[model samples]
Target: MTELIAATGSPSWDMSRTREMVRARWGDKALEALRPVLRAVTTRLIHARIHFQDYQRLVSEHLRQPLEAGTPWWELMWVDEEKGIGASNYFFIAAEGYVYAGVQAQHAIADNLAHVLYYSLGWNVDQRIPLGKVSLGTVCAQLARETTNSPELAPIQQALDALSTAPAYQALADVTNHIKHHGGLPVRVGWGTSEQTPFEVLLSAFSRKQQTQPPREIAAFLEETYDAMSRAVVTTGLALNEWLESSVAPAPPDNSLHQDSTPGGQELHPTDQPARV
Candidate 1:
């Protein structure tokens, strides 16, 4: 019977493959736990893509100007001598209440939706973290502690705490970390692989430090930082997008209607027009 079972040709599965299978089989529950975080992540990703496109456009424009003028290409135009030519980068810091509120609200709504899905699917809370409650209180306590010392951080910290307690936040955090570590463009930018921006440098530094931290602090600090980073990146991205859209050059006027002037002050007009001596 053992030999027969072994002969059935079932391929061995690795942990990642197993997890994927489980996720698929219990997608509804997983999604419920993930929707809020995923939605937040999706919005940020969209913002990032827009920012990257804008940055590319800016570089293209800078490169095109000298070429269009029939002038020798200037390396200085393509490279900011001091800062380097690239899109400005930003991140959401919990110090900014308005941006934090928006992110928290989106996360909260996603959490509620996930809870509804979980309840509808009849999944047992014991099988997973009761993200709807357990984690919420923990985050609230942490926020209270942190805010007691810094009143300015109160509102944003409170909002972040609310989102942190949600299972969806965890799911989104996992996804974002994975993407950053892997090959996603946002992560590539975040890691300082694109153009060097202050935010990119900070994120890259954080990523390197995160690998060495203990698990508990890693979780806590990451949760604290995620919203802040998101806001900064999105703001920077939007600004760059606006700049690119507004910077487009107007089409040239009809050159045929004008006359060219020589160095000796002689004018040469088109054959159809009377020449000025």
Candidate 2:
């Protein structure tokens, strides 16, 4: 049986079948328009993984040293870029850029996906399906509503439902929004023990604080974001392709639209499945 993969859970896609169905059902231009959007975002997500890995390594080096009052903690950063204050900050900013780009790419995916979906559903190219300012859950509900009563559309609906309810998808959206509208991810500054002034240690002594320095950190969140975006490409494409297949496989009567697109559904938490890149 063909499994409906969760959004953010990568799955193997039959590219030839997917292409044929989209061309036949939604027209050649439909796939043409959508590919570039997915390509742009997916490409960025792929490279972001590398940058995150390097950044994580850089952060890890600093974490190995003990944060003592007289030790050469972050003060050695100039000679050593990995554990140095300047280098860590630079990597953090670089990592932030990748995370922020993923967020932008998601918006691009949603807007472009809506355009392709609306046009395929018989709406004019000029008449776009509004997807701006709406959550991923909202978009899924609207699409599922558009496909109600047509069992042929059930696959697409199930995919949408899965997207609506998946925690990773939700977290993906939340992270994207937070980064875009809320400045960006908080990569807090960690103090170097060697750089710590005597007065700073004195204050720590009075408070009886063992937590004198910031926690050891990595850009794990950004790496996760990178993975999430990469997975979304496959999962979302699967949904679109399955819907297209259903549309073309069915007779005219079965494919006719009887209901207007509206948003409504109880989001279901999707079970785990095999993951792919």
Candidate 3:
């Protein structure tokens, strides 16, 4: 059941057994402090999964709803019978929206993992830890520090390492960063024909430095990103579950909790106070 749950792209840390173990060792306060952060992580996973599935559905539907026989594929239009409006490339446009949404959520999950790992280490509040600005690389770097002394944390470090180092991970990050900081990448959505049959294709140049790079299939690119992100989430969750189960008896020290304070003289805890994202 644990394997199946993780395989389905749900966080492994949410398992009942893991929660029970955490509660037994860390006390109810730990669970209480972590509930919201875990929920936020799961929420982003839900968004990413929904967008991925929706984009796939749209791709399949677009293939089935091809232009009428002999009609030019370039003349892509959607007619609203009630409003008497014909919108151009509406289907692909909607699918593209899902693509962007899924990408955003997937990247956001990487950011959220920093919160998960931090809180899991028993730090309830610390102003030094950047909440929203934390990146996957940052998370991996923290994990490196933790695993140095506690070899038991090696699995967690490995899981995050695989995620941060994956080619698709960097590609997706480049695309998302480009979208956020620079401008949206040029995307081409239309119908194409091959020896087999006519099909819909959504293509984009993912290279941040080269706009003229040959366009790659958006569906395939997103599929790779989704798979990589899902695997990382599941693997991290499993590693965390193991950590929680094994390290439960001696609660880890809250290194950051007592050492830092917010500007208002309050301890920086994400549960008790909102951390700037």
Candidate 4:
């Protein structure tokens, strides 16, 4: 399964397969106990990947406008330039939103999974972890401490460590924080000479910090980030599955903690069979 997922070059999860593994090792109660949070993580994961794909598609399809060598930064235009003033602005603005939302969703996946781990370990509300905030770094730090003493959680810790150290993780966090706390992040689309294509359509962030640096293409960066997130997702899923296989039955879920988090018409329940991306 791991080899197949890697070969596809895209992240995929088998929700029903996970449920069957849980049911066979533990019972139906454990399956139900974990379903809600798993579904929430799934929601964020899918959305993040989908947003990235959409951004790539939109940019690739519309980056056909021709520009000369001396074209001004403000003059190099997106596809909708013929429409009027501010019409082309929508193109870049929408692309910015896609990247922002995609990064934010990737960050949320960690929190949703942290919630899963928090309950799986039977930590009570008296525990001082700030589960409500949007700090992946903070939640992951607490998880590190909790998992350090238990050899059973070693695999989970490895996944967390990989995610925390991933270049994409920190880069996305910086961009997310800059947008949320500092100020606006403007998206710039420009043309440059390239060996592969006549027009190298560059999508990049604009801020005071980046102003001193040369504008570089971000396609590789975004692709790297997405691949890193995919690896984390795959590793985390396998770790959880293995842990469930060796563990005792989990306690029944507190009904109050189970909320309706499923989006895109998907249900929170998982079946005996494996699912596809």
The whole-model lDDT of each prediction reads 0.33, 0.45, 0.62, 0.58
- Candidate 1 lDDT over 36-95, as tens digits, reads 432333343333334334433443444334345554343423446365443222212211
Best by TM-score: 3
Greater lDDT among 1 and 4 belongs to: 4
Q: CA lDDT of 66 in candidate 3?
A: 51
TM-score of each: 0.23, 0.56, 0.72, 0.68
Off by over 4 Å in 2: 1-11, 57-92, 102-138, 189-219, 223-233, 249-277
Pairs with steric clashes in candidate 3? 125-268, 125-269, 126-268
Per-residue C-alpha lDDT of model 2 across residues 1-277, encoded as one tens digit per residue:
2222345643544444544555556665765654443343333443444444454454444433433334444463344545456755674566456445644554455444444444444334444345353334555566666667656656555655655455555555555555566466554444533533211110001111222222213343443444444455455556666766656855332213322121211121122321222
- Per-model tally of clashing residue pairs: 10, 1, 3, 0
Ranking by lDDT: 3, 4, 2, 1
Model 1 worst lDDT window (10 residues):
268-277
Candidate 3 lDDT over 1-277, as tens digits, reads: 0122222323434444444555566567766665555555656656766787787677555544554345455444445555323344565567668877878887887867766676676644553356655566777887788788989999988988998889888877887887788666555665456635465465565556764445667767776776777667667877887888777665554444333221211111111111111
Question: Between the candidate structures 1 and 4, which one is better when assessed by TM-score?
Answer: 4
Clashes of 4: 0
